[model samples]
Target chain A: MDALRITHVEGTALPMRGEDVDTDRIMPARFLRAVTFEGLEQHVFEDERSGSVAGDRAKEQHPFDNPQYAGASILLVNRNFGCGSSREHAPQGLRRWGIRAVVGESFSEIFFGNSVMIGLPCVTVSPDELHELMERVEERPSAVLRIDLTAGTCEIDGFTCAIGLPAAARDALVTGAWDTTGLLLARYEEVNAVAATLPYVAGF
Target chain B: MGKTLLQKVWDAHAVRILPTGQTQLFIGLHLIHEVTTPQAFDALRARGWKVSRPDRTFGTVDHIVPTRERNRPFLDLLAEDMITALEKNCHDFGIRLAGLGDDRQGIVHVIGPELGLTQPGMTIACGDSHTSTHGAFGAVAFGIGTSQVRDVLASQCLAIEPLKVRRIKVDGVLPRGVYAKDVILAIIQKLGVGGGVGYAYEYAGSAIDRMSMDERMTICNMSIEGGARVGYVNPDQTTFDYLKGRPFAPEGEAFERAKAWWASMASDADARYDDEVVIRAEELTPLVTWGVNPGQSIGVGGRIPSVDASLPDQQAVADALAYMGLEGGKPIAGMRVDVAFIGSCTNSRLSDLREAARIVKGRHVAPHVKGLVVPGSVAVKRAAEREGLDEIFRTAGFEWRDAGCSMCLGMNPDKLVGDQVCATSSNRNFKGRQGSPTGRTLLMSPAMVAAAAVAGEVVDVRELSAEVAAGAI
Candidate 1:
């Protein structure tokens, strides 16, 4: 089977400035009523984008609403992005909303895992470097940024910085092994063998 | 060197090192709920894959189940459709489901332990982030996304990277008013919300050892809140005792054998951890989150942190303050609470209910405050009602509700209306966490929520304890 290798991602950037932005904010709990994740992109940051006070319909000043960053496929964020709730919907919504890659100072482990599983690469840079990237994105929302998973670097406007993706994650992305179900299913016998050895599974 | 429980459990479950350098670790148990399973089931059908270990997988309807009403064709049609989808998926896959109207039905985390399905030396995967709650049994449990859920269903395994283990030791006895909720909140405050990323937390020391199984569950439940996907306690006599006669636990001689295996899975005395953090239980006060995230908390007696422009987290602090509509430097104690809630996988067990009821026995909820007490599970609700704890809460003017994740994430009908400030016993104070986009949450222990319910504001639970002792009420 041919694997889909994602060696590099290049796109216009959208900068959302916040620290510890939780999944609940990305996709509120009410939107989770659906049986499928379809149409979740429309509700990404639904509450944050629309002010909730007194049923106000005025759109909040959010980067997702900024016309300059319209159609941007790269998300630039600050420290601890996607920090709460293990909802894969957070990344799914972001991906559906056209965020192909995310570059932040840090990411919640589950969010990182979920993003990688869906073929969306989440890479990290130093806080200082991330601030610079956010500034660069804000200065020119149309600036194209490129994330090289194999090279482990992010470059924008002739400026380059080291990006951090765990070696395992990077290898998986570059090899298109991120959707791990097929890979895991191939080792079915091995899985049963391991389970059989456990006292709990083997009934002591 | 000796091995930590994480290493031992991981090594035991590991099938092989994949070509991508991730481990193919077998999952012994896979728990599913309404919200995250339908898409996974669809993916499985798309691939024409059968559940590899249907016996090991269990399903429950919780997230979108309404707490107040439980009739066919739910008031929320979307919720009914989601639960119906889960039922159909579970039925098609031959997975056991504790759906609505089943006594076993409850929050997945609560029902798992209550039924003894969560055991030590196992790898538990659930579609919910709070799956870490199962780690209280010494299991290597963590939350997985829908794709990983699909992987587990197809292969009973996950391709994942290993994590470093951090030993968090909290010594000494907890103060009178402090509880496991406070201990975890204190730990999150000491360690930033993102501090535990890429690591598993091994909760040790005398304080953790002294906690009951429920308290330990409360501690492990919020590991995800601290960016740690897994947190656990070492199995001991307490763990064994809790599992002794549990419905799913082994019987007679088999139970003894399982105990031996479970005890052996505890971290060796000389085990090496990647990191260690030591905290004193005496220093901790009943903590309350004053900001949006769990880490932005302080002692009830302490003031909300004032934002300093020079600090790197200044923006975060400022934003939280702005969103919470509170001034920094103000005491967290007397903040007006429009709602008081006690329930979630975090603290809706029998003990949590009993403790909250203790404070609500003779006290009436403040007229202006909307008080709610939701039990975590049907079993918990039954147990609390058997003990007449529900009567105490109802008499105190708090709405005693059925079991579900009500008002916790607010996927159900129980939710805050607007910008109401709620003193909640559940975890997570993120923006719109309790249903209303503008609703604000102040997370604390159940007793503290009860105190706030009566006082119409946040008050130190210790003060209320003292009042009870003094016969002031």
Candidate 2:
């Protein structure tokens, strides 16, 4: 795979206003039964969007259910989003649903790591700025939000806010160090050499 | 001037600093289970890569395995496919698999310690979030996603940033009936759910030091619920004693040398912490989560926390209260329960079973309350049955079953039917976490779950333990 470089992302924004949106709610445990993450986009927020109880998905009311937010590529969320479960499926589902970047007041550590690894840049903005941005995004649905990571700013029609990414994470996105799988594979011999000396490996 | 245990372990395992400034740390132990490993193994196959150190990796089948029906070709085709993929992947990769029917098979976290694979000073990684459960041994263990799991399978290392260590010190003695589960719940309640973000919690002080290895595991298992990526207790004599003569532990002289090294790896007496928070253990009571999140909890005798307009997460509190269908000021102890689950990687150990059995031995499960006890592993199952704990549960109208992560997230057959309210010993209380989207879960200790099963409502385990001791049944 080519090294990932995410310098900037520009798209219509989908706003989810809530604190501590957990992974279980992002992609319910029932949907996690699948062996692969394939076709999980349709099931994102399955419970909240469809109001399903047990495999029944008829009623629908959540914001994601609205056709207005269709094809939106930028996700706008509130504090401590993705706060529970270390399941990567949460990020994978969001990615599959076409989200390229997320601008939120805050993010859980694991969720941030998972999103960064998958080439989705999660930027943190001040709460006041986030609220202003969310209002602008919801009010002007036709307006495109531009998130320039290199410039460290999120801009829309009537709002512009400074966004923050950890320096190391930003470096990864800029230099393509985010996808280290190739780099890891390059050091195969060194890894095996270290493994050979460990007592547990030797004993086996 | 002294390094903390986390720093020492992290420094020892640092392979190099990556361009991203994340440490390319070597993983001493890599554990995998059925649910998360299939996609990871597939990722490796797609890259034409084989496991770098199969000898250092271990596999097991949990999450999707049925606890009651032990027969092959599981009724759920999806569950069967997942387990089969794990077995095939482990075999092809030359990794040891503790699959069903194997004596070593169990929850990845439980079996790692039981088989002596989880040792002090190790940097362990697993695909499951509860990997922190092994931190009870003083190891630096963290959960990884499937992609990271694939990374570990290919290179036996992870590129990760270091975490600041927060020392959470709980002093004094814990009152009777308050288990480690209650201690963690209380901590999460006091410190909001997101309080531990970007930090590794080092549980310390007299209270933590006095806890058994099992209790420490129970405390660390729920670190994720508090938004901490990892939580641990320093390895002590108790940790070494628990590992003594286990199936894979060091032998005789080697054991002595390993113990010395492990003891030396403990954080220094004068180690400086980034932050410290102290709690009086004597003041703690049995805790139960009152809302959808684990942090929204109250003591057994306490009422739900009223939503304060001054609180930052007011909307969050309101949302949780709505999802739970609970009034803010109502008492939690008498809340009705439709089901009671006494299992999970958190509280399905031998001691957990013994304590719950002590409360359930001569009692009948309340009518209309479905109770179930799933041991953490096959060995735990056999051990419980050997000690008649299984009999106690079965006779009390509880389904005493084989080992798997049953009803905890409910990937298997054991799930909450419809909007049933369950008193559970599992770690998470997230909405629909028990499989049914509308099902409600109350997180508590195993013995507390037993009390709920008997009373058909949440009750103080201390009250039941007192009654049982008084021989009033």
Candidate 3:
């Protein structure tokens, strides 16, 4: 696990292009057996790079090759970003593929929840803000997008925008916390307390 | 003043209703798969806890298992290890698992119902979204995350928030060409994807009542698309008849004892609901999604809505259109597609494939398209193969692969390429859902997708009535 410090990178907006990019495309379905997130970065867009699945040999530049948007990590995508089967590898692939966070106009609820649970910042931005961010990335590829979850702002060039995440989700991302352990530890108490009120829990 | 069916079930299963408006409900049946169980079992072992009810739990080898070859030392090392781990877990815990080569070995949802293990009035939980498919038998089934998977294994119960019941009543008669796949697409269209969040959908009314057991499975399968944690239809004669002769079903005196019990679990005719959304069957048509979400849909024979929305009512319409690269008022039919998939828990039953095979009989695949037909379970595959549905699918240029989640989510080898459009029978038309980030998926019925494959584009099954009406096929 190559642990890198999240350096509060600026958020550049780009309405995620593509529909139904299931795990196979995100990290190739073949890599689901890869035990760990090691060496997954190279397989990010295996379909496009290998020209194996659905190839357009004539087209020189697929979406991933746009020179202006090189090295940008925070992706702004359209609705239903991940809607296929529940393969954890899709998020792992994105996390390794330079996508520190995704600000989507909308997200598959499961994908969004899982991303947050695993420490990936997936926020829902208004459509206008989504479009503006995409326009910014297109206009200036070298332009840094200052995405600060601590400040609740995605600043690209001269524009500063708010990506509205529910406070609970926002707080978890800002503080670099995963509440899975705490939630699990508290379940016994929660169950007992509720059981006391209902009385049947004791019988069970 | 009235107890809805949901309330009745909730009360029956509730160990306690929590202050947070959730319930600590005991699960009657818990199903496990290969991928999600390892971590869950590890979590249990770390706590040194034993499985609470091994007899009530069942395991299966799917998701990670390779569909093609059936030998040891599997090509995918991680999958082989996961399979080995499950075998050990099931053996150690005294839980029964339907390993491959066993007749009962099939997709969790498909086998659960077929073996008569899935009973109405029970709560079924699995670490899979399509667990709702068992709801066709009136069982209250829900999908859980991995951690929740651990909880079920340890305690045979879940801490869950109570769901509001949305009585999604479909009335009148469906058109000749429309199937359950179309019914669900229409429902998602009427209610946005998140419309059913925090709710359980009770499928009712004349249209739903008229469907077969297979069709009911299709409707309940996509409840997740409506953002409902669970969706179900009340048990009726169709559910009873389907279970009567199955392997796991109780027989004779025991059957009589069970049926009487099952009957009592059906929603009372006057059951009240938290919310109700009604749609006339006549208003619905064979529908397909032209956008990234299932909600971005249009009726068969309709044109893709244009993205040029200069007004307010047209905003969502515009967003859908732009993302899909659809031109306003362009007919959805006859639009070119590169692939077609006919399978999923949603529509990979014998009847669904039979309908697709019936449509594609004596037809040649379009030179420009790639089509596939995967059955939902091994039983479904065997039944279809018995009827020689494989030959028809193969003869029509589709790859007749083994039963698994083939292309539904592209977890296995099935997927789409960049910008290539697919007419799929599986649920969800989200962006890149078929494998390529740029790949587009259009949700439709198996027959509709067959039509698209035959025509090399979206074509309404109603127009090509030759297969059903003309009998030329």
Candidate 4:
């Protein structure tokens, strides 16, 4: 019953189908001015959702802007989601905008790491499974989708499929150890010892 | 099985295995910049902790600094505030900062290697994704989130999951006018943007071995774009020669000792890898991105890809074509460009500037195109000016600007106006990357960007080089 343990996530899903949806598209660089990540929810996908890009044909029906997907806590996306930039702001914005978890075909390594650090689970499903989940969410935006990290399964409308996450990431999320500062600090002496052994740190 | 350089470096830096099955890895060097550190510092305060190893940390102001104006209290209040916060944070945390007035001030990635702070066999962490740029020196460096930034600040350690090593071998000599930028672009195009996920790219083969250290950095800088969190080259004579006598690098006997350790850290001849990819360098040409991502690119002589309904990435291609306002099957050459930017951590070093200057020496930018050349660092600026590269650019109708990541990400005032097509040397071509929401970006080599500026469109740099040799400019 630990509040921090994210063994399972169940909520409405928002489908945004696009490969390599980069961090810049998720949160534009202009909004990165503030020292804190506050108020980022209002600006998530600010450019795409608002059709700010000139001649952008796919701007009209951005899932973030669609009213049907409002309050959706799970985001379903295609491959290579969050591809460019190491900005934690992208995942922060998604989390703040009511996205608790993401199910995608694939994710960039940095983006995947950033999401886990913030306790936003990013699981990968097979292409077929992701397509089916996206189609289901589009057809029934209010349908509840459940992801169980411990069991590595995603269930929607009684259709069950395996989801993939790194074993370490799954353990961190299930044990509430995703915010790893304390876990890292527990071995502070060992860290210093390792640093001392490095030739570069000791100036050879 | 023999060990890859990644394995050796990882083993060296690993402190302990955490309870969650992740390794607690000690960071040898931590680089910080204005955009990502304010919150990280605040998090440290909340935890009642101090930076465990200030000596290992370095800070700089780059993302929000204006390349045009060097004055205090920047016109952009938010930019000014960011710099001020970094200044206060560095001072409070006892970390050294290369502020705007400092001669060493520049892009974090640029200054780290320039000042010899990035060394081989060490684990470097930065808040910026281009931290992979340091891996050119055979280091295990990767970008981290702000929370990990706080972790390194508090304990000089991070909970990290190990990655598999992928050996990307680019053999054969590069044809003239095909630069390191094109090599990486070709790799990204061949391997889908996400192809390198869960892997550390160990760049090898004859072509990589022959490249200068600066060129190696350019190749490593964009590894993140290919979804590899870490990328590196094995340390060799090129790496050691570049490090010797640099400001922060060890002196004389110590340097000799360090070089031995670095060379030993290289991957063994029989090192095992999870996967292997081989590319022929001679087959590559000057490449350019015509879509929203780095992977959506074509060679200078190739046409933009047409969207076929049955293709695996058809929807992605269609979306890219729609956002870029480009037609399918059109020749990438002669695509109109309104802006030309020759700067960024990817291609703003001395050799990059020299190549661009060589192209623009006797030519002028097209009247309709705005051209800029921002150096990567103040030292680079001074060096370029000393070589009179600035005069060459200014005379060629390109604005010679101060150091920083000028129009690369457009964190500063130098940006593309609405819908302007920019032929740039920056890494990412993500939509709105250069400040304008709809501004289009074409990623190319610096020489190609220079040639594009002169032609006011995309043109083959090899053809332009031939024309330049014929005195046709």
Candidate 5:
């Protein structure tokens, strides 16, 4: 993990508009069969789109079938995004799917943790500001959605929109401290001191 | 203040204090399952570590081990690899593994108590979240993450923050048909999901004290759903009676010593609490959730909250209403059900099955709905079948399956097909959590699921119970 560095990669924003979008929709449990955690980009949102074949033709039945937000990365969800199970695979599925970060009005607590743990930056914009961004995404599929972690803003068609993140999470993203094993390792002395007084632990 | 059970266990287990003001606690018992233990065991091996306290640890295979078929190497290749790795690891580390076909094979939580491993005045930690189920015997139990799992495997101490204690007292008595499942669901509704985020809840009051060991386990099982890491009832005579002749429980002279020790763990009558709330058991009703979250619930006779009710969580309510295709203020009961599942680590014990069987005996499941009853453990399965409850379930159109988290989170073969709406006895009701992303789960009691299975609708279990009481069946 690099020391707190943020790089902005401009991409084709594939926005899937919906509410209460859950983890199972993000990654089908069947795909969980493959070991080594690779070859998953094709399966992200399997239940949502039947298959993860990227396309632009709009269909009315499925929520992701909205014409305006095809091939979008920065998902502009309505509210209470990812309100479901604590499966870490949810955010892993999103990252594998070409989605960089979510700019939703709010996120479920477990989803937020899953996102942060897997290095997918989830930036929360105010509901009103988020509404404006979603409107722009819905208004123009080709419009650019720029999320700058350093700037703490998302730009829709060069129009800047503010978002907020907790300082620890923000710093972690800005300075690439992805793995937290070091934090625990650094406290070896402190942890051992506490462990010394216990007997059962001596067996471990 | 005199020591409450919480304080006694907390003090006895306190290893050291960290600068963060949390106590470094020693875990007397550690349980590992196949799902979360592989990574942890790998971490230990990578560090050239041996399991520090193999005697204090027990391993079980349940999550991926299908209750349907326990054949060699497993049907799922990944599950087979998991079991293989776990078997190799346990052999290498000298830790006993309760592999499938072993009498001890069952959900980690269920096997612990049945074997008398979940003793009072001990601090227990496991990688699985429902570890609080062991706390019914007055142990201080909490679920740890994988990293923590590795830590416990390598070193038996957990660097943890001490939680503030809160007392919840339920007075009087519960009305007929209001089981422990309803009580936990009701608690989640009243407290919101996050109300107990940082507190260890001490369930007090007369109702708790009067409950059997099985009943208390149900209440503590959903402590995590309420955002509390730990929930427990004080050890009383009921607890002692239940422990009398278990395999691991002390015997003869040792039993008296153990009894005295267990007695010390109960909270002093005047023990202090950080917060206190009381509920009247008489006021509780059979409860059910109308949404994905456990907190979105109402009593059996109650109507759903209106989106216009001015609650701050209204959007959540709205989302739930929309997902369920329900209009706000509608009654949760009488809704059509396509499936009914009665199993989970949460409520698939012998008592739970017996209660469900009482409702389904001589009755038939609605033609349109499917029903199943999966026991929590092999012991539970054996006991249930010995009593012929399994035949009763089969006779009523309910499938009798072996033990595991079947239909609980849909990790195994049992799952909801398509968009079927299921009345489930599991702990969670998240979207697609029951196997189909579009599938919906209505969390209720085993008895309630039984009632729904027979009626093909979410009927109040009380009405069915009243009829059963009157020998209408």
Candidate 6:
């Protein structure tokens, strides 16, 4: 994979309000049965939005199902958004569902790491700022929300709030340095040299 | 101040600090299963990358393998394709695979410890979240994404941020009926679901010290549910004794040297911690999930929590109640169950089966409920059969089947039908986690699940244990 840089994303916002929206809810386990994540877009939040399995026909109230947030490219969520299962499909499903970036109060450690590798940067803002951003987006669904990684800020119609990203994540997103696989390949000699001395590896 | 066990293990594995400011840590062992590795291997092939350390990696088919049938060409075409893909990928990459027919084949977590592949003072990685299950051996094991799986395959290292260590001590003796599963459930319930974020939990104290190797594994397996990316128990005599004489463990003089090194990996008496919490083990009871999340649990005979703003997060509680189709403030013991499942990485070991069999013998499943028992691994299955545990289950009207992760997360054919409420021994009680989007899962211990299977409703396992002891069955 080539180094991919993500300096900024400007798109409409899909607002979701909940704490600890785990990965299992993000992409249900049944969808994980597929060979690949190709058709995951239709299944993102399948249980929350569709109620297809239960046939409740109530049209579960959720932001993703709202026509106003139809093509939104950025997702705005509350604290601990991806809290369960370490499956990469949580982010993959979101990315497949047209989510290019996530702005939240906090994210689970594994979810954040998975997003970073896929070039989807997850930024954090204060509760006050998040409330303001959500209100602004909900008021005008079509308003352009800008998330600039280089500037560490989110802007909506001249209203800007400081966003926080780890310095390392920011540097990697800006300089297209997130491809750790290439770095590992370049250090092949070092890895083998280290592996040779380990008893477990030798036993194998 | 002395460093904790987590720091000592992490520092030993740290290769260097990369330009991105992430630590380039070497992974000593890489475990893979059929469900997560296909995409990873494809990505590696797309990049024309060869596995840098195939010798250190092991493969198995667990998640999608049917627990009821041992025949090939699975009834589920998609599951069959996944198995074939994993087999081809392992062969092409020179990775050793413990396929269905292999004696070693089983859940990735169970086979690792039984084969003695899991050791102290090592870094382990796998595509499955239960990789934390391996941390019970004192290694820092992490569950990686498919992309990271590709990363490990090509480089045998992962770029990660260092985590703070929180020491959790559970002092005093455990009650007679409370097992390791109950201990972990109680801890997660008290700490909330997201309490351990950005921290590695170091389990200790008298309770953890007295636990057997299998019991320790059950505690560590669900660390992910508590929001901790990794959880570990410091290696000691118990850990060493469990690994000794196993298939992959060091032998003879080498074993002595290995034991000495492993003993040195425990946290020092004066080790510092980023945070600390203590609980008295005697105060714990057999706990079960009352709602969607693992943290939304109460004691077996306790009432379901009333969802309101006064709770930790009222919105979450309300949402959980709504998803679970349950009313608040009701007794949890009388909830009806349509199915009962016992088996998963969490509580599918020999000891777990033995305890469940003891409760189930001379009893029969409730007419309204369907009961199934899937062992963790082939070895566990054979061991259970030799002890007539399978016969006990079958005679009690429980379906005795092959070994795999059955009814756990609904990855295979073993799944709950729509709207079915299942009493389960597996971890995670999330809505629709048992296959059907509307299916309900109540997480409990194996003994509790067995009791529910016969009662057709949630009942206190202790009550059943007492009856079994008095020959009431």
The TM-score, computed over Cα atoms with residue i paired to residue i, of candidate 5 is 0.81
Greater-DockQ candidate between 1 and 5: 1
Alpha-carbon local distance difference test for all models: 0.90, 0.88, 0.73, 0.92, 0.76, 0.89
**B233-292 in candidate 2: lDDT tens per residue?**
999999999999998888888888788888878999889999999999999999999888
lDDT of 1 by residue, B429-455 (tens): 998999999899999999999999999
Give the winner by lDDT: 4
Write one digit per residue (lDDT tens) for candidate 5, span B213-280: 88899999888777677899988899989988988777787778778877777898888888999999
Model 1: CA > 4 A from native:
A1-3, A50-60, B471-473
DockQ of all models, two decimals each: 0.80, 0.57, 0.12, 0.83, 0.14, 0.64
Two-way TM-score contest, 2 vs 6, winner: 6
Which segments of candidate 2 are over 4 A away from where they belong? Answer: A1-3, A51-60, A188-204
Against the true structure, what is each candidate's TM-score?
Answer: 0.98, 0.97, 0.78, 0.98, 0.81, 0.97
DockQ of 3: 0.12
Q: Worst ten-residue run, lDDT, model 1 chain A?
A: A50-59
lDDT of 6 at B45: 88
Question: Residue by residue across A1-204, what tens digits does model 3's lDDT show?
Answer: 113223265544333454334434455556655334457666666665535433344234545555555676777676556554455556766777777788776665456655665667777677778878778777776677776766677777778888666555565555544323323334555433433442222211
Q: Candidate 2: deviation at residue B88, Å?
A: 0.6
- For residues A1-204, write the lDDT of model 2, one tens digit per residue: 234678889999888888888999898877778789999898899877644653243333566877788889999998889987888999999999999999998898888988888888999999998988888877877789998888898899856888999988998887777877766666666666655544444432
Candidate 6 chain B, run of 10 with poorest lDDT? B307-316
Q: Which tens-of-lDDT digit does each residue in B258-292 have in candidate 6?
A: 88877787899999899999989999999889888
Ranking by TM-score: 4, 1, 6, 2, 5, 3
* Cα DockQ of the candidate 6 complex: 0.64
Better of 4 and 6 by TM-score: 4
Task: After superposing candidate 3 on the true structure, give the runs of residues whose Cα lies further than 4 Å from its correct spot.
Answer: A1-204, B17-21, B76-78, B311-326
Error of 4 at A167 (Å): 1.7
Q: Candidate 1 lDDT (Cα, whole model)? A: 0.90
Candidate 4 lDDT by residue in tens digits, B73-131: 78899999999999999999899999999999998999999999999998999998999
